[model samples]
Target: MSAPTSNIADFLRWLETERGLSFAGYPELWRWSTEDLPGFWSAVWGYYGLHHVSDHDEVLADATMPGATWFTGARLNFARQCLAHTTDARPALIAVSETGDPVETSWDRLNEEVAGVAASLREMGVGPGDCVAGYLPNIPQAVVALLATAAVGATWTVCSPDFGTPSVLARLRQARPTVLVAADGYRYAGKEHDRRPHIAEIMDGLPTVRHLVSVDRLYASGAAPDQLPRPDVTRHDWTELADRRARPVFADVPFDHPLWILWSSGTTGVPKGIVHGHGGIVVELLKALGLGVDLRADDRYFFHTSTSWMVWNLMVAGLLHGSTLVLYDGSPTHPDVNGVWRIAERTGATTVGVGAAYLMAAEKDGATPAAERDLTAVRSILQTGSAMPDSTWDWARDRLGPDARLQSICGGTDICSVLAGGSPLLPVRTGRLSGPALGVALASWDAEGRPCVGEQGELVVTAPLPSMPLYFVDDPGRERYTRSYFDVYPGVWRHGDWVTVDADLSVAVAGRSDSTLNRMGVRMGSADLYAVVEGLPRIADSLVIGAELPDGRYYMPLFVVPEEGEPFDDALREEIVGAIRQSLSPRHVPDAVVPVEAVPRTLTGKKLEVPVKRILQGARVSDVSAEGAVTHPDMLAWFARFAARLGSGRS
Candidate 1:
């Protein structure tokens, strides 16, 4: 609950003693972050060894809402910083699957491939400011295409391979990319599903696409033109394109220039395109790597994620610090449930990142990796995508190792960086993010816009920080960006997270403010109940929502997915009620405990509590058009029947 100390001081000492990193103006760097944030960010651009073609005299001249600018007259290349270490001897990428097969690509080889693709793009008349989209998985080739697009100043957009053809078309149609990269098929859970048909359907929807390049993931003999949905769409092989190549050149642009376009999970509506700049992203991520997680040069970083998640973009910052990144493409549990742990052990990963839901799933399966693997090399374990339950923290301490640090981090795609997270200097509390990030003036304000301690409220930032999205692609003059985060507080940024900061300054994330339920008059976050219910041994995961009765009264309805063989009997329900009543108030207790086979989640592994609540109200869920809505839609029908039985008082 004390004020945060200077993180720059700690970063400097760690850099000198532990990381062996040297830089000029160490003291000035500390002052700029705290006193002059604009100067601090400007210094980061130079300190991190970024490539810039132009320089500016003014670091920052405005601090207004939705109009702030950094390094006003500077120009830089995003792809150059990413490919700074390009060489024949250094390994640029190391991709491995759950089956223990490894694929390696050197920096020089990757650069050569990128050059070939860039030359081909020029031949097809794809120039700067054009959009190039990728409907692919997390592979080396995807990274190559992205870099190639950025090298030529073309915007890069991507979606995971799991998305259906309609969903892919909906996004691509909005962005209208000229070139599309896809695969014939991908392997998952030991099955090869053909994506050629899906790709063909996508190309049919995108009439602007001039070229469709397919990677032979299945290793087939020849390309079939009849298999493609659009016969007019020209096809190119991945290897053949690499064979005819040229040297890639970096394009320089303004510091605030657009680099890439990322889409928000269209859970509520059509996904919005978020555009970020090169200088801001590079500097902000470098600060996050050095001061946020305290990443070291020799460290090996691994996160279980797809190309769709922002974590993939965040993890690329590790390369700036000279760390080896371990990429995993297949399911975390392929042939067996222990696949991720096995990879961690073999790779000697120092930092391991996993979604909170995955950790709970492992606990549900009674998975204990302590006896099966050696996790001594792991220094910190990062958990995000949702709030970390208290039971998961206990499992990490007891099962993973006693000495390991469990850091529960919280941030969203809007900023592409964390507003508050774990710090090495801070103590790891039971189920709380360690503390506020350096230079991030984060606070918890109530509905009345009053800052209060020991009270749950909306999380907001008092000042502008680096890495704020430059613009929304569809919005003209930045109207949507202003309405999304800045409209709530005028000048301050209101992050859509419901959280509580204790008197001690320790942070606890409740849930998304947009998803918080109001029962009668009291506001309750979904995470408030999830933390309490997940603490029980009988429950693997639980979703809590407020359901309206015919009499105009609202009651909390709980749906639980029990561990392997556990049932939702009367005794187990009583135990769950007792725990909630003891930890929170009596109002937190659920009116019913309905057992389910699986809880619904988005592609990023976040729970869909609001959509589930709608189903219980006798509302039609099929009318809903949210991106990544319930992976299994049938589960909602089961919940509806259970709700009907509960309403009849038949239990």
Candidate 2:
């Protein structure tokens, strides 16, 4: 095959011939980037044509964890760079939602909308360091609101409208936003959900919101939130304020100024609000989109994600490098497992992104997008959210076409961008992420802290990157932030994943290491177990936890949600056990196979394994999570009560 031609390759070629800087391969380029961080970053700023209000004198001043600072003496507005690209030259965005049809927003109009909102927000006394929270869907208005907040140097945070009141309040209350931009309701699965009552609860719970701007999405449905208590503090007509000012006044702030606040899963205790800066994110996304994903100036990118997910932020960041964004809102599997592929076909997207769970469901649904749909425009298929099973790679290949690449990208909400994933320079391998993301000093360290290659160990970043959270909101002295990552490995950032760096230098993630399953001296991930179990047609979903008994025997309980109306009979149990033994080792079989009504998941769709493990291991339910933050709070009661019965020796 011909050598891959990408923006990074071209940039590298340019450096060799024009700038007299030569590198033989990506490893050398990576080394130079991590070693001389200043040179690497300055080159990124120049290469991407980022707009800066003032020049940066120092690329990185401090390198300490939770203390690192980048782009010293620089001033810029992230919104300016995001808007600088063009609505006319390249299509800015095409938005499709369950509530409405596809709506295309040109760069010029998008700029106008952002400017309009920014002007109103500034007039409302929002400025640098202020917070603007949104309870919104993945719609155009959410994008506009976010850019407007960034344009005026205000910190932006968001929660999906689908989240319960307590979940939204857990993070937004800590942000203490001056404005809360929300929706009256949203549609999903061919049904409209009215959120006006939830909006009232959120507004009442948060005393800091000075303005309530509600997007009238249910106009045709004719369902609106109740009248505002204080007209001065709230407004239902979103257009009135957006039209009030069509010219945005941009604000230039320090490089380290907070740009957005993202929340943790909140499965344990209160959620943590992670703060990330403008310059760091700008540089990081520019490289990530341009090099890691090979997004060209005109490539149309579509990632199936909610506004609440960090991938939503990446959808907006595509604008930074002049990539067209197709923002999608609604259930990916609403109409069926093929719904997301239909979106790619309709938008003529060059890249299609979805979580591994979506792919698994599509497999179960027997979806065949390649045969049923025309996706000739798609060039890359991106998968994340969970580890992509080796078997699932075949499923991806059969549906996405042979020409298109299927990349299992890995990143987290904490960074808001990929730390390891596909690269144009690397060879694509089935079931393995290509390698460490450029500029990230990643290594797999064993329990004794020795670097391990071709073996599973803790994932760690030995050096600091710009996109790591600046700090956690409300975390004084960085106490929570410190314990979250650094406490495990001292100076190194422990990413909490069981990762194996293979001999080929490719990376394979084996789920979270803290919840790693060990039996008879062999260690396996819970994801490994679920992969086999969920593949069975009888199993809709499953959760596995290795509970340690006082007598030192490890009790492995497999909780499964049976398929609708399907009886949990002896025949089904035998099949499950046979599959596990055939696919995995004999010891991989569960000690107890229990059927449950539902499996607890986060609002973002992650299985609640760690929290469930603690509950099953005799920890108090209250210690695991607060009721409101959990997606299925009542479902946890079954696990807790079961644990009690088991502990009392009455089961």
Candidate 3:
């Protein structure tokens, strides 16, 4: 086996030597990659030494936006690709928890467990096209279950135990998995949550779940699996399923075979079950993580995430590069404000990825994690979920020292990979993404479908990406899929976020375009407002909502959650208004500054700007966001009450 080097460098060398292609820099390489998608993607397949049972001349068969077919004749399994790179000496997984000490799972152990579970699944009649749903946490067992499902050619989907029963059912019922694997409970914030009852409710809701596998995390060895809820349902322990001595065998399914289902945030409605194929994920992850993020075998990749979030799925792909994955199953700031940093320090994590909100809050709290912990091993600090403020970015750079590169990445669960993020060859910039990812024809397009530069516009992809969803579950006619992405631009994938592409191609993403704020004929993104508002010392968090009333009058309100003991008095409000007027513009200033207990966010830590705007515009709470999909559903009621008092008839 050939040794792994810097993947992007290696690919560039391969392009020059094998393909007779040479580029001066990343910009030229990226341009060529997008222009010749087939050549670039085929090179990725070959450079990674991907093994397939059948070969195909067509890298991408159909270039249609919603129904693009890729690598049709090739056959491979995601499990095989994930496990093939690592050696016996390297650890496959490092599982850490709030209460328990860190445990390392070797590649041999992982393969054995995967083989055992795959055999057990085959015995239970699970096969190709069968769905195996997981209501598991971020643990080794969850990894084992997903790999085993892929090994047997069964599709896999998962939800974190943190999600309530309704949220779990809302997503899982769409897939209708034949087998369900769930943990007995999970621990978070120094507390244990018994989810057996919640699991029962989930089982009752998903009648298609014929076999139930229980992972005993909170229970003892003598504990028995729960009784089957119905006569047709059978119960099995996770350990029992993984105890058999068996050899690993992978099913060589077609390249476009369903691998996994990832759910949208469901902030607007029921989450869409996005299905991605095996070859697409395998190829894309190898490129996105290996090239874009420069992940290496010696690197311990740790991304603070839950199973419900897409980052967890992306983190598992670290195994594709023979890198060890560090999985933490607890609150980011549980034992202390620097808990996550401590985890990185102890694990010797080389790459750390976390939501931007965490860094912002830590900056507000005056946290100096570098001073508190030894983070010298860290080489890259990836921030996602939302754009970071300039001040927070500066603070992070200063705190982490000069060695770590701070990268702000923006993507969605729809792709289950990065659209625009950091590349090893690109220079780090403050409060801006590096550039469009290679093989992504990303652009900022105005309403007229004209590309825009140095100005905010709809983020659109003019070409089909391999990692784009094969199809949304239950959307047989592709109506939902088309309407979701290609509806706006007609044949182009219009990601909902607003972005600005500089002449140099560095991208800056504002908040969601749908939630953009327009006042007195002046337009601005919510993220621009947040970058100013959240940077204030007195403000702990904030949300801005703009609603057009029945009389065609715009009502914009800036809701601020004051820092502890900091009141939203006239003085503070005036400061906020003055800051916006100075930093941005007087035309974009809010009509009112209302203090709130907290700002509502999705489970993944995105502010509920659009949903709250709908609530303030007199929309029903149920019509806007699913309760289970939100971090604080109770805030929806408060917003509704405030709307009621404002009255819809007000001018």
lDDT of 1: 0.75
Question: Model 3, 1-651: lDDT tens per residue?
Answer: 974566788889988998899999999999998999899999898888863445775998899888888887888888988888546597889999998778999888888899999999999999997999999999999899999999999999999988888889999999999999989899999999988888888888999999988898997631233534576788888888898899899998888899999999887888899999988999999999988999988889999999989999899999888899999999899888788998998888999999998998888888999998999999889899998889989999998767898888888899999999988788888889999999999999998999999988999999988889989999979999999998889999999999999998899998888888877756688888888888788998899988896556789999999989987799999999999999998877998899999988889999899888887777899988876888878989999888887884442
Note the clash tally of each candidate. Answer: 3, 1, 0
User: After TM-score superposition, what is the CA distance of residue 599 in candidate 2 from its true location, in Å?
Assistant: 1.6
Best by TM-score: 3
Question: Candidate 1 on 100-207: residue-level lDDT in tens?
Answer: 566667778877888888788778777777988998787777888887787787888888878777667667888888899887766777777777777777888899
Error of 2 at 588 (Å): 1.8
Which is the better candidate, 1 or 3, if ranked by lDDT?
3
TM-score of each: 0.89, 0.95, 0.97
Instruction: Give residue 35's error in model 1 in angstroms.
Output: 5.3
Better of 1 and 3 by TM-score: 3
Overall lDDT per candidate, in order of appearance: 0.75, 0.84, 0.88
Assess the local accuracy of residue 326 in candidate 3 as a C-alpha lDDT between 0 and 100.
97
What would the per-residue lDDT of candidate 2 be over residues 1-651, giving only the tens digit for each residue? 984578888889767765578888877887787787777777787777653346887788888776788888888878888888654576698988755567787888788888888888887889987999999998888988999999889999999988888778888899999899988788888888888778878888888888888788875422243545554475535787666646657787888889999988888778889999998888999988888889877789999988888999987898887778998878897687788988888889998889898898888778898898898888998999887667688988987798898888888988889988998888888878988888888889988799999988999988888899989999889999999999878888999998999766699998887788888767788888888999888999998888676656788889888899899988999999999999987889998899999888887778888898888787777888755666677878888899888888765
- Compare the candidates by lDDT and give the number of the best one: 3
